[model samples]
Target: MKCWWEHLMHLPDDLSEMGVVLSRVNNSYTAASGEPVNTVQTVSSISNREVNSTDSEHSSVIPIQSKVCEPEEVLIPALPEVACMERGYVTPQQVYNLLNAEEGQPALYDPYYILVLDCRSADRYKDSHVVTARASVTVIHPALGCLISCIELQKYCIILLYAEYGCSPVGSVKARADAPDLQRCFFQLSDLGMDPVILLGGFSAFHALYPFLCTPRMVLVEPERHMLTIYPSEILEGALYQGSATQASDYRIIKNLHITHVVNATANCPNAFPNTLCYLRLRLTDDGQQDLVEALPLASRFINAALKADPAGRVLVHCSMGRSRSSALTLAFLMQHRQWSLLHALRWLKERRACTAPNLNFLRQLITYEEQLFGSRLTSLDDIRR
Candidate 1:
């Protein structure tokens, strides 16, 4: 006996060819042409109907059973293990600092090393892009060759991908359609074993935040408004001091605090005490996006060496503002020297310096460093919030 679905499949393409008028009644289909055509009820509806209600004339009808087709399993190729730092997100301020870093300077993390790709349209990219950004329609196949060539040349290349607003703008019907393609490009680059970071809030947000840095024609704003005053605070009893550039420059305060060493955590922040004090200048940026992982070990060594040099020696760590960068290094020092957990060290520092807190990315790197030292993570997202 033929199945009901098989019979329906054999129907004429033009239903009118057989002079048949197909109509549905309740859960069953009926064909009205000559006499009342008895059709097999659907598998679902068959159980619901009374079996005895079927006439002897329709006894030959066969009910078809529905079978579900299972989806085929697919194997995805694993990406090669590239020895690279975790590429997360960068901000406009960090991008600006990277572009403005002085030439021939020794930087812990070089922004020039990373390849910034603007994923906007060609016209939009032509109008303006981040100072060092390259325009790309797609970063998959065609761009892969160039990227691979750069890798072969041993050019430590990290890819930074950004779209218009990090996502399709609201009410942008066309952009919404193409949003998935942009995301696919990012993932494809990652799958190709390249370190890729997506800029947070994208080009629009960056342009709004740093318009002067974005285009050449934009005028520079006043510096005083952006300038932050320094106030050195004690991290350890007398061994560690965390402060800003201003605080580090104040010779009177340095003398009063009995400081012997200074750790400058800014890219081009000059050494205030040239011959008077021992100095270790780390070409670091205060921006949250700057890579603190690479600088952690070096900064820790400097702090430890300073403390080990003399029992009474005092080290002062400072950046443009002593809040983020200096605090991060101080935390790293405590974690490395005292073998304290990241959270415990942060809590200890916070007790002395109320404003001691690293940027989100720097804190994440500290967490990573903590895990590297210990066997597991000692801090979590909730701990950071506290």
Candidate 2:
């Protein structure tokens, strides 16, 4: 008899050959591992024979003896850890399962809490953010220096961004200035009974990841003439619009993009001239009955016009911050295009943009409004907007 193990080692990508001991037994023997291990094909005629590697003449006979049972099939992919490191995720199948599952499961085999933080700017979020996410603070502006803060704070869940990847990505880009710090942040936070999943693409990705959980930022405004403005030019003064600066967060971003309309959702502002700015604002409330019926559709129209009129011309729809109102309007645009139902629309949107929180009240009102308009007609954010 010849040694089967020696010949098995030469096969390509064979895990069984990589030392998964295949011990043969009586015909009635069941595998203790219960993993559906198949028996050797020629088990009936096989006789136990241990061949020593020191014996050089047995090489030729070994090949014939080992050709009995073919190698077990490779069912799933053996993903490389390094490949996962570059993509910032385990697998597309895993991400899809996560997105599709209605309820989230805890970390495998361990009771852990996931912490997600909104780290846009230190000045903006100074001493702010979800309390559960304090593992470390890594700022996403002016060279991304918060690596130490994250390590010290032990932040587990970190969502870093400032005006859409406009900031951060600094600190010798060759060494993964932002992501490396996130990895360290999670590792440190893991020490404190927490598990972190940093938003890979920023808060936008988180918003996309969980849209139904979003709350809308309210903008209470008084109707002026026929449109709405988040903050009047006089009120904005030095706070809202800024001069030409590629990196600054101001009206210049809209102007440089040659946007036609600047739809402001902030309430209580008097109107004024365009003044190199984009378009006018459309309020979302009148006598408090969710003014979005008038505002949302108009916003949809303006965005459509902006995109079609120039395609490159951008439309900046904003409230006090870019979190709520702007996000809602953008979502509306997306719903209109995709014809998705309100729930599905919200779900899909969050899976793509996660920095938003659709206020529960706002969501209810939008759903109600959509239902009332369609009246037994299947409606979604996408259906109404388009």
Top candidate on TM-score is: 1
**Candidate 2 residue lDDT tens string, 1-386:** 11222221222233322333333343221223433343221111122221112213221222223232111331221211122343223222223222222122212111122323444444433433322223235322225544444454343232322111212333335425544544444444455544444444543443353332223321112222112111111101111221111112345334333444455655543222244544545444322344454445445555555456423344555554434555566555544533444555555444433334556456655576445433433444454335
Worst 10 residues of 1 by lDDT: 45-54
The lowest-lDDT stretch of 10 consecutive residues in candidate 2 is: 228-237
Per-prediction TM-score, please? 0.40, 0.36
In model 2, where do residues sit more than 4 Å from their true spots?
Answer: 1-153, 159-249, 252-260, 270-273, 321-328, 348-361, 372-386
